[model samples]
Target: MSDDPKTLVSTDWLANHLKDPDLRVLDASWYLPDAGRDARAEYHAAHVPGARFFDIDEISDARSDLPHMAPPVEKFMSRMRRMGVGDGHQIVVYDGAGLLSAPRVWWLFKLMGHRDVAVLDGGFPKWQAEGRPTEDLAPVVKDRHLTVRYQNQLVRDVTQVSQASKLGTTQIVDARAAARFRGDAPEPREGLRAGHIPGARNVPFNTLLNTDQTMKSPDQLRTVFEGAGVDLSAPVITSCGSGITAAILGLALERIGHDRWSLYDGSWAEWGMFPTVPVATGDA
Candidate 1:
């Protein structure tokens, strides 16, 4: 029932507003290399009615060696225009793995300076389980010019992260699971070191969600953060395997009205691969 379009929207809210002319629903499904699920193929098979597929990897910064870095402003504007998503449209992004990948897209939209976007609570699973309408037909296209004003403060680089870790000024929160954060589990990426940045706190993104895969209440979210020993009052920077799931933490932070936050775009993917930066193993 919360009408905060900048954070999240429930399945019921999306279902009720399906027909609104200004509403734009996007299927932003993506999986890690180990998941073995093809997001584009799945989208072609079935999707919410009138929902467009937002390819995370395809619509990204191709120049970077890293995986799915944010696309340039011109590229983002072009992509949105082609998809008929532009100014004044209220966007709702969802993914196949419930709350997994949608928040990344939501964060991307916000990073591009679009605030009228949200992630679908419980995502595609919840909608389908409720027997909501779905279709495979591609939506009719009508190009619309999308304005771009990138929010530089919303993203951080490895250099900035290194400085923060050294200075202990920002609360760096790692979204990787406890095992990964502790270096008890090997990283999925090859030739990368295990463990996390020094002075960082672990807050696995899944801890903030309910059993049904929907995000927990605001009070519950705050509890989860506090339980993880995170200082919510400090400026926060979220990170994950490849900078993807970290956005889930970013979204959770926003849900609780924590605005002074940024996502480390390189995250562990870049951090682990480099030898110049220091790494910490085991729970502190």
Candidate 2:
């Protein structure tokens, strides 16, 4: 049987399917300053064979004052074209630190209306541990005219999110760790509040992933959501410290066949920066 698109994958699943013609692997690695690892450098040192690097920072909305906002349709199309990511390709993305940044790439593909994408389970660490093939050589770049079809419904602005919070029409899922979500942990960035949005449910992005960094099965993922008081049938919005990991939740929701979901672009970084925005902490 085919695997569920949402939750996670095993190394065995990936090893056996490596030669599939439609499969397109990507190294979507990004790291925080404290981690002290360069994703591009790591990708250059060694990567899965035929895997290309997906630079999240380089491909984002350059004009937006917010960090790493979604780029315009034209810029997205241009970038994908340079990367040779044509439509109809089955994309499988992975990060240096397991599932950290790959989901953002997965979410990016979906936001552009491409659904046949998945995050590599366990990420590069597991792939290397299994003695899988690796390459220092970069893949030859080929141009493809990847067109963009924007799906506005899959995104939420801060204003809309605030409105939703008051109406209780949408459930907000915060992917930050418990400490950050509760304001008990210091934020990585300076001068920002540490709590989460009012009424947001804490579902750390790592919980959705296995020890090896692969996603869990759809049934397992559904349980995780329900446990966090998230009703999949209802409207959903994902947020995180800076809007990155939240995409992981968005990817999970998409994988589980829940299409009525969006990523809060500004996320806590913006919301917390402003004292006027409603901030709530503790178990609510």
Candidate that scores best on TM-score: 1
- The residue ranges of model 2 lying beyond 4 angstroms of the native Cα positions read 1-9
**Candidate 2 C-alpha lDDT tens digits along 49-111:** 889899888889999777788888888898888888877777788898988888888888878
Model 2: number of clashes?
7
Misplaced by over 4 Å in model 1 are none
lDDT of 2 at 9: 53
Model 1 quality (TM-score): 0.99
Clashing pairs in 1: none
Candidate 1: count of backbone clashes, pairs at least 3 residues apart or interchain:
0
lDDT of all predictions:
0.94, 0.84
Candidate 2: pairs in clash:
6-255, 7-215, 8-215, 121-214, 122-212, 122-213, 122-214
**Model 2: lDDT of residue 139:** 84
